[model samples]
Target: MKRSTPQEAPEVQVETSGQLPPHAAGYARDKVRAVLGQAPEPVLFARVRLARTANPAVERPVTAQANVDVNGRPARAHVAGHTATEAVDLLQDRLTEQLARLAQHWEARRGRMPVPGSHEWRHGSEPTHRPDYYSRPVEERQIVRHKSFSLVRESPDEAVFELESMDYAFHLFTDADSGEDSVLYRSGPTGYRLAQVHSRPHPAGNVAVPLTVSELPAPRMTVAEAQQRLEATGFPFVFFADAGTGRGNVLYHRYDGHYGLITPAE
Candidate 1:
């Protein structure tokens, strides 16, 4: 008779950029493993990136980002600090919190109460410092990235869960109830707001989370128009219905100071 042991999952893959310390990659891998190892669900894949800025003026020169797939769900976290060690430490904490919130969402779906001592998660006030955008003139910037995909159809609460766990500033999806393309984002420190292609009042009782629907309708504009408006308004992003297709699209500023567009797949 023979006994066999189950193989353990592989260590997290770590990537580095810029002039990082030699031990930076290994340290990040260990830190990421420490966090994902305690995940409530199986971690299918995990990758961490550590980057350093050469500019000394940047307060937080070291940035760390992690993307992980827990079972079938995706979660992500990004953080920055003065040093690689600090950045990795912050990443671990943020990733752990994200996974916990995700696990809570799963528990609720199963009609089970949240674990003991677990409280409702709220948006933190910490600012994530991304790469500084070059001072390129808006007129010179071009639409460098265009992403097209099928939007998920889900409830507001589910969308919120995904948005926070994935560390997205805004999430574009199809509203399950209204069947309209919608964007969900943080309204304030503790609340969320929803914007729909056809603006209409949403019944508060239908949504379980703290949410408010936008009263103004999404503007219909072409990509070029949206880009001009974004430049004029200095808004982080613009959500609008495409003038040509009548589908929702998002025009936003990338970290590189270029325009990026997101549209639903045809």
Candidate 2:
């Protein structure tokens, strides 16, 4: 059994879009220190974010988020409470559990599965459900976030690794061998899928294209991989080069939520 020897606690940086109360600030620092104290390796850095939320729960009107980087791996947790102090306590508990799981996951991969019945408390101890964003009204469904990154050419396996490492639900990359645009995403805890796009752009409506088009480099990949990318992104369609024939193709989502592939006939 490996134990973490405590040294100096890493600095905790707190950022707030709105003002945070002084007591809340102090509580956040203390809770973060408590969580990091249990980490297998000293946390490289820790961050706390405080924000007001629209939640109607009287006991959880504020949201707290903790992000910690440990030995190049990152773990994060979010909690809400009526008071900043309550939120800080919850966040501390969550971050501690997450860090423990991270360490255990690495260890389990090295042929050490925890004795199942011996640790019944650890089994399913964490909440597995996620809030359903679609439950919100359509009028409130506008995009609230945007992220941009360069497309790296990678295989399905490589894309899977990247997705997990970044803690993202999906990943986009060009296929190194097929020269097609592809995406990788988790279908379940134990499974992953891929999608790819067509090589050429489809006919568009009578609307002007974006004034700025990013001339991105494309990589060759399998059609199956391209299809997965198309599905994961929830895009209306995707355009990419055909890995098989090096021709342009289009993968589109149908009204029935199924996928359709359009390729120029040779």
Candidate 3:
């Protein structure tokens, strides 16, 4: 009888949009493979997208984004640069950092001590450069993206870990303790703040990390009303409870200046 060999996992597929260099896709594939190849957990699915804006006024027209499912947990990174190669380089760096942090998180969750010098958590090192917002006037901006899904239910600590590892400015989830729709975001360089549909004071000992609950509850309004407030206030984003469904919703400004909305699925 002949011995059979195990099949190797398929290579991650890279996708490109807008006008990119002919070699952009291949270059991105090589970079992604190099990073995901060394992931601590098995990569079940991975996708890379590279897009370029045709507008000349944008300083960083090239944008690169990557999403990877590592052992059932998802990790994501998004970055922008002046060129395709530069963007891919930044993407690789960001992905590597996120994965390292995620590995440390998993180790802690499993009651294992993280390897010394394996990773570092620095709030000051978070990426500051973001793609320029669209030059279009705010009044002309429209809601270009709307995402609806069942919000995850997790502890505040778990939500903070996901927010950092996924490079999200804000994370929306259901509070496991209070059973309320909540949004978690960075408060300052070192602390985090939580806003919920029905705001309530939380005991300081409830969360291990430095977290504060918002005194003001999430505003109740329709999508249209939220849009108007966003335009009037020029806030980076708005978190509210949908008046009709009473579910948590986030209306934020995209890098392109267009509005993007995230809401819980009914």
lDDT of 2 by residue, 132-244 (tens): 12233323333232233446766554454455434444456766766666655555334555555543232122212111112343445556676667557765556566678
Ranking by TM-score: 1, 3, 2
Supply candidate 1's per-residue lDDT for 134: 49
Winner on lDDT (1 vs 3): 3
TM-score of each: 0.90, 0.50, 0.87
Give the residue spans of candidate 2 off by over 4 A. 1-4, 17-21, 54-59, 105-137, 150-266
Go through the candidates in order and give each one's C-alpha lDDT: 0.82, 0.57, 0.82
Query: 173-264, model 1: which lDDT tens digit per residue?
Result: 99887889999888876788999999767643456667889988899998889988999899889999999999999998876668889999
Weakest 10 consecutive residues, lDDT, candidate 3? 1-10
What's model 3's lDDT at 166? Answer: 88
Best by lDDT: 3
Residue 183, candidate 2: alpha-carbon lDDT = 59
True lDDT of residue 91, candidate 2: 80
lDDT of 2: 0.57
Model 3: runs farther than 4 Å from truth?
A: 1-10, 114-121, 127-129, 203-206
- Judged by TM-score, which candidate is best? 1
